[model samples]
Target: MLKIRNLVGGYTNTPIINGVDFEISKGEFFVLLGPNGSGKSTIFKLITGQLPCQKGEISINDKSLSSFSKLEKAKKVAVLSQEVQISFDYTVEEIISLGRFPHQKGLFKTLSVEDKEVIEEVMEITKVKQYRDTQFRMISGGEKQRVLLAKVLAQQPEVLLLDEPTNHLDIKHTFQMLDLLKEWQQTKGLTIFAILHDLNVAALYADRIALLHKGSFLDVGDVDTLRKESQLETVYEVKVNAQSHPTVPKPQLLMTPNHSKTKSELLNFDTSFSITKNDQFIHVQFESPLRTISNGVIGEGIQWLKHFCNFHVEKHYNGSNPKQDLQKWMEKYEIPFEQSVAMMTAVRLEDVVIVTKQIEDIKVIAVVTAGTGNAVDITNSSLSQSHEKVGTINSMVFIDAHFTDGALVNGFMSATEAKVKALHDLNVKDPETNTMATSTSTDALLLAVTQQGKETQYAGSGTVVGKVIGQTVYEATHKAVQKYFHRLQK
Candidate 1:
């Protein structure tokens, strides 16, 4: 546990830290975030007693930090600074063994069996055992960081201070270091205080974040509270967009780029598409890979792809695993599987419906192809159907507008709701459930956009973008569904 209240300090005649107040709960992974020269490293110095506090108090476990002796402080707190320089050619094992000096009688004292065991364990934990005899200067930058970390672990301190520990490391090493720290914090209840530049990294690991600006604490709270786009934009003096991580549900910040775009340049839509029809399939091509979100077989869910195909499969075609079949087809056709999105249906391409609408000067387009073979009313499905429909419905929405990824996700949700509402309006139902059918069992939806013009931040139900998606998808889907039912009657 660490506590700092009304903390003020800096070099004489030039104060760096303003009145700062915060507390780190026991065993909490707390992070400090700010731009360069925000006095983050200065705070570390004040806490470790390298720089004396001009005012206020810092305490560890209710004990004043100033009360601790050099050895006492070393035993309770360990710091890894932003840079570590090794001018001397010291062996990795020898460097790490120095951490045991605080516990021993003196630096020159004979090493004990317990010290050796701790050194071995720390080396193994940090994955530096193989480099034990190598000179610290001979290893890679990431290896040096790991070796230094092993030394700090050898100190057996309860509290660890990391100042941009991931700086200069590659992605792999950065993640490896943080993942190890997280594991240690959870398993050993090690308290950690770190300063990080990457907002996403802090969100992923920190229990709470403290934002510092110009030697003062701007805000301090949980990740979600401190990472508001407006707050971060003001603090960092840049445009910021907050979005959820696709897999983790954590808030991540993306810095908006600043540039000038003329009206003519902004209006130039770089997106173009071509649709080709064969006897058994329809191929859709894009001028470039579009940021697409879909449930199609190949390019399913939030990816960049340039091509898609809607194939006509037989009613009795093996449907046990559509993705597997798609994979086989892609390999046979020599397609770049990762760059393609594909779907299948018993209905022909001629039956697809395309609808276009304009909302608030933005253009929205919807393409829908429907089938009822696999439709089900999700409410009362206990009754077994005498026959199962093997058809599929595939829909695509394209917008001549720009959107943030978060807004795009919201647009997808709104579009789906509109499609189901269209079905309800048509009185479409599943005989088993006696309720309106929302979506078919194997339905696929694709959301794409030209990403031109002004940026739309939110696409919830009340937004203009949402309204356009609702109206266009509803009209298009209604027509497609009606066509499907008419074909069924025939």
Candidate 2:
């Protein structure tokens, strides 16, 4: 456990750390975050006794830091700074052996069996065992960082302090280092205090964070509390958008650049999409990539796409892996699979309906293909009929405006409701239940936005963007359903 109360210190008479207070609990991964020259390293120096504390007290395990002698402190704390300099050309094993000096006894200070075991263990854990006989200066920068980490771990100190521990490592090695540290923190019950500049990594690993700004502690709390856009923007003096991580319950900050647009670019909301149709499929290519949310065969979930496709399939088309089939189809057509949203429908591609609407500066385009071969009243669908291929109705809505996350979700809801309304008006029925069909068994929908023009905060049914989306989807779905039924009658 480390504690600081009213801690103030600096290199000179003037204080860089102006009276800040905090504590790091045992086995806690506590991270310190701040802009450059924000006294983060100064605080680290003050705690490590590299700089004298000018004001209040710093204690480890309830004992004042000043009370610990050089060797005693080395046993209790180990520091892995941003850089380490050694005049002699020591081997990797020799560098790690130095950490055991504080624990060695007798004037000879020989390496005991326990010291050798610890040294080997640290080298193995840090993945530096292969380089144990090599000169420390001969390795790469990242490898040198890992070697230094091994040296500190060999000390077996109760508390570990790191300054930008991953600065010299690449993405792969960065995660590996942090993963090792996290494992040691849990297994060995080691306390870790680190200064990190990558907020997302801190958000992922830090048990708690302290934001240092202008020689003072601005806030100390969990990642969720400190990762707010307002807090980060003020502390770092840059614009940031904080969004939830896709697969985790953590918040990640995305930096927003100041990109200026010309007057023509800003006002050009009427950009047309090129539609290429064939008996096999219908592809619509946009002028630029659009921010999208979809439940398609490919390019599902949140994506940025320039191509949208409705692939025509037979009524009995039941491929075991439709996604793989769609990928191959896209490849055959020379369409980039990663930059496309594709869906399959039993309906004819020639019968696909397209509608466009513009309300003020915001424009909405809706595309639909419909069939009733496997319609289902979702609330009354049979269990035996649940497993079906792609649904008959495939709908997509595109908006030429910026949309917040909430607006994108709300727009999807509005479009779905409009489609259901169109079905209800047409008296489409689920033949098995003899009741009105709410939707197909596995309907797919896509909502995409240009992510330019004015920002829309909400797009519920009552909002202007939502209204346009609803009207366009309803009209397109209605016309597509009529064409499907008309073809059946023929």
Candidate 3:
């Protein structure tokens, strides 16, 4: 464990870090964050005794840093700086063997059996064993970084101090280096105090973080508490958007650039819809990509899509892997799979309904293709037999406005509610249970937004935008369902 009390020091009489105090628990991964001139590296130098402390005391395990001699400090602490200058072409093995200097006995400073074992173990852990016999200067930047890490680990100290250890490493090596440090911290109880520039990486690995700005500690807390948009924007002098990571529980920050747009440009943002239908499929194309949330056979979940497809299949279509089949169909058609959202419907493509409505500056477009042959009353559907046919109802709602994540979800719910209302009013029923059907067994709904107009926070049924969405969806679904029934009568 390390502790700093009223730490104050800098290069000259003027101190870069002033009156800073914090404690690092044993085996804790603590990260220091700041801008270029925020005194992060100066603090690191002051703690390592490279620069004399003007006033205050730094101690490790209740022992003053001033009391530890050069050899004793080397045994307790190891430092891996951002860059190391090597004038002589030293072999990787020879460079790593130098870490055993403090542990060696007598005047010769020769490597003993324990020292050799430590060197080999460090090389293996750092994944630099193959480059052991090569010259350190001849390796790539990432390789040299790993070799330097092996050299420091050869010291086998209790605490490690790293200054931008992954600055020069690529994405793969960056994760590799952090993963190694994290494992060592968990297994060997090694304390880590590092200065990192990447906020997202720090969020993933650091146990605690300290935000420094203008010679003072702005904040020191966990990732959730410290990594706020307002705090980060003020410190870094840029606009930022903070959102939760999709797969992980941690928060991530996205930097937003400052760009200007004219009012005419915003108003003229193209959201025109184009539909092309044939016996095989119906395709809807948009001028630009829309932020979407859907549960379709392809392009499910959150995505940015420019094309929407509803592929027509036979009434008895029962593919074991419908998603793979849809993907193959897309490939055969030469569709850009990554930029499209698709679903399969057993209903006739000619019976589809499309409606577009404009309310003041906001606009909504609703598309629906409906049938009740495989409908299911979800409340009592558990008693019904399984149906493997394609979904009967496939609906898409497009809005020419910006939406938050909550608003997008609320809009989807509103659209679904409107579709059920349309079915209830039309007196549609499930063929098996003969009860009023809520939806098809595999109904798919997509909600997309142009994300260009005014920002709408909530899109519930009560909101203005939600009202338009519900009305448009209800009208479209009602017309489509009637058209399907008309076709059956013939």
Q: What tens digits encode model 2's per-residue C-alpha lDDT throughout 62-88?
A: 999799999999999999988866789
Worst 10 residues of 2 by lDDT: 381-390
For model 1, the run of ten residues with the poorest summed lDDT: 262-271
**Cand. 1 Cα-lDDT:** 0.83
**Judged by lDDT, which candidate is best?**
2
> Per-residue CA lDDT of candidate 3, range 125-160, in tens?
889999989998888888888888988888888889
- Whichever of 1 and 2 has more lDDT, that candidate is 2
Model 3 CA deviation exceeding 4 Å by range: 263-271, 381-385, 389-391
lDDT of candidate 1 over 305-394, digit per residue (tens): 878777777766768898888778767766667788888877766788888898677888787888766666767656575334655778
- Tell me the lDDT of candidate 2: 0.89
- What are the C-alpha RMSDs, in order, of all predicted structures? 3.5, 1.7, 1.9
Clashes of each: 1, 0, 0
| Model 2 regions more than 4 Å off | 264-269, 386-391
How far off is residue 357 in model 1, in Å?
4.8
Candidate 1 residue spans exceeding 4 A from truth: 106-108, 260-271, 288-293, 298-308, 318-321, 331-341, 356-362, 383-388, 402-439, 454-490
